[model samples]
Target: MSKKDTTYILNEIRNYLDKFNNASDEYYSFIKLSNELSELRTTIQRIELADASIPYINQLKKQYDAKEQAYIALYKYIKHGLISSWYETNKIIKDIGKISDADLSNKNKQMQYLNHYKTLLQENNNIIKPTLKERIAYSLSNLIRKR
Candidate 1:
């Protein structure tokens, strides 16, 4: 798993906590699921329209399944009122961090692919439109290089 992917999730959860603190009805998990569902819906539609390969469709389906499970779990947790303050939010963040950390460690057990992916992203950004994506790519690359 990429740092960006996990960091995006963490930032999203933080946003939801902010919303909840402001008396919003939306929970972080719910918003996360909604965003995932929206993304998956678009991908699924595009794949179907293009008559994508079976293996790719199967892969998307597996991802959809995983997101569905996460949504359900989050729904139940929120339903039980697990979130109340920063204390509760930190616990939830730690749970997600643990899973993502484990995934990253296991991925690195084969070989650290972080630099390779970052390089590819930079190359793509160099060739593509210099929009927000490119700006983020540039910023993240700089941050990574600094470390």
Candidate 2:
């Protein structure tokens, strides 16, 4: 491979690694948030039992349940992002490894390789299918902002 082509692959790998790291960080955040929310729900349940006579306690319990479900859904979305990023990173490394053994000295061959690389990136982009929870969260956020 030419110097430029080698540089391109190296840069792509570096950027992909950064993305993978970020996704991992977000995944950790999601876990932390989920745990905290679980604790909050437990506390709420305890309170609901202690103050069962409160007139609005049932409504409060229902809202708390909805919030807990939303957090669980968000956790799923972040976990999905983490797993997909890891898979894509591994695939990128493998693809780059294969490139190192190929002949790319000819200009036409180099162009073909570049095109193939673009196609691979496109495929990776297409794999980020949003979960239903993610779509709903986005919709809710947008609705709130419209006020």
Candidate 3:
């Protein structure tokens, strides 16, 4: 996919939420958001697996990496408090053991899990968005391992 795809998808989500109106439009918007998020997830997987020696592909990858970081920062800025609080996120994990048989059918429990899941997405984005030093170290390790 083009480098702009993910950024555009994220911006679409942000714009929709910012201008959100008409409760009647919510159902369709939610469905569209779900599909876009699914697509974004797939695009992320592809970005992670992409490998190339060509200069153009390498350049595109770097641009995508930068864009991803910007997109994440913008998302956090725009959707402040949309992600669950860190304490709640941690508490949910702790409380999971109290859940008998991991019953997800309970709407309240399910909402907790969903919030926890979104918190994880935020945390995972922070963790996985590699820094230049980390990326260089990874490249060196790969080269060493191949020898």
Candidate 4:
């Protein structure tokens, strides 16, 4: 990688980290929102077959989907940056392309885990409902433990 590319990749990594933190917050909020939506949907389904409240539920679902897409994109960008940086630092002059090809295979596996989590969330939305406050506390605890 050129020096400029490397710098750009580093900045991208930082941006990804920041976005990841924000996504974590959004994920928690989405969980709460999903729970509320689930309850509302259930109530609406019970009370009336067709109602205006359905749109609210649909809107929340769309917001959750958008947030999920953003999270996936940021995760891919960060993982790509990491692997590309690693390959650039370690590969032989003539083997850089091969290195990237191999690394991308591994990246695909990493993404599989991410996709699995996404699928799990979609399948059992209530299985992972960490409140925003709980997420913040968990993050702070993890940061402190790292130190």
Candidate 5:
């Protein structure tokens, strides 16, 4: 994928993060975030398929997986009525916005930023716990599945 495409995806991620901050509807915020993440994932997949020889693709994939996991946790929280603060994510978005095309062109620098961003998201995930509603929902789902 071109740097322009990556930059656009990053911008979309930033926009969604900003929306998540002030949005009254948690479900809408979660859906927007999910779509942005999907776009990012698709972009990464295209890059990997285009050039499997790219040494940094694995690192990028790892970062993407971490982000997906973290976001899944965030979604769970959102579904349970526990709205997460986007302060840390917004900071990461600002850092991403500062990344120049030169930085994006460099595999090591890109990996470094991606790894750091993934870590920040993971930290936020660790801080969030599923609300009682989520636990109850899970239990109900399990019971229904056993039938």
Candidate 6:
């Protein structure tokens, strides 16, 4: 994923956690983190192929998967009232699981994108070395021209 996107996701996750209450924080935090991770997964899928760093991408994917599993377990525990509300927590867990699973498939797409970006980079090294500012300018010019 792009650094900006990653940072955005991390910020969102942090924001969600910051608002968590110890009384119900675990459940709420898990749900928020899961949702952010799912969104990151989607964003990652879109740019994985464009990134030059495979190891980094893989690392992020692994981290996201771990977090997802953690959230799932937290949800289960909350659902059972092992730590919190049973019925309410169970309902939230079920909802999060359904949406999270559907969105989880994007991780595979991110792997594909990563591979594609690697290949493109290798094949066109001469054209991909512009500084970030230059790239942004070029993209903006193109956008403006299109408009």
Error of 3 at 71 (Å): 1.8
For each candidate, the alpha-carbon lDDT, in order, equals 0.58, 0.64, 0.47, 0.48, 0.62, 0.53
lDDT (Cα) of model 3: 0.47
Q: Which whole-number lDDT from 0 to 100 does residue 137 have in model 5? A: 75
Prediction RMSDs, each to the true structure: 19.5, 8.9, 18.7, 16.9, 21.7, 27.3
Q: Give the clashing pairs for model 1.
A: none
| Residue-by-residue lDDT tens digits, candidate 3, 1-147 | 232533443343344335434322544554555566556666655665775346655665565566566556655433332222222334443443333443433455443454454455456544334456655665576589799
Ranking by TM-score: 2, 1, 6, 5, 4, 3
Residue 95 local lDDT, model 5? 57
Query: Count of backbone clashes for each model?
Result: 0, 0, 0, 0, 0, 4
Per-prediction TM-score: 0.38, 0.53, 0.23, 0.28, 0.36, 0.37
Give the clashing residue pairs of candidate 3, or none. none
Residue-wise C-alpha lDDT for candidate 2, range 29-128, written one tens digit per residue: 7777777767767867787778766656666667667777877887766755655564565566565555543453346655456546645665665466
Q: Which stretches of candidate 2 lie over 4 Å from their true place?
A: 52-56, 59-63, 99-147
Candidate 5: stretches off by over 4 Å: 1-29, 82-147
What is the TM-score of candidate 1? 0.38
Deviation in angstroms for 12 in model 2? 1.6
lDDT of 1 by residue, 1-147 (tens): 566665654555566546556543547558978798889978988998999798998899889988988888877545434223333444444445444435645555321343333334345433423456544655576589799
For model 6, residues 1-147, the per-residue Cα lDDT tens digits are 444543444353344334334437666787798788888798668668687578877877888888888877877555433312222233333333333333434566543443343344345444324455655665676589799
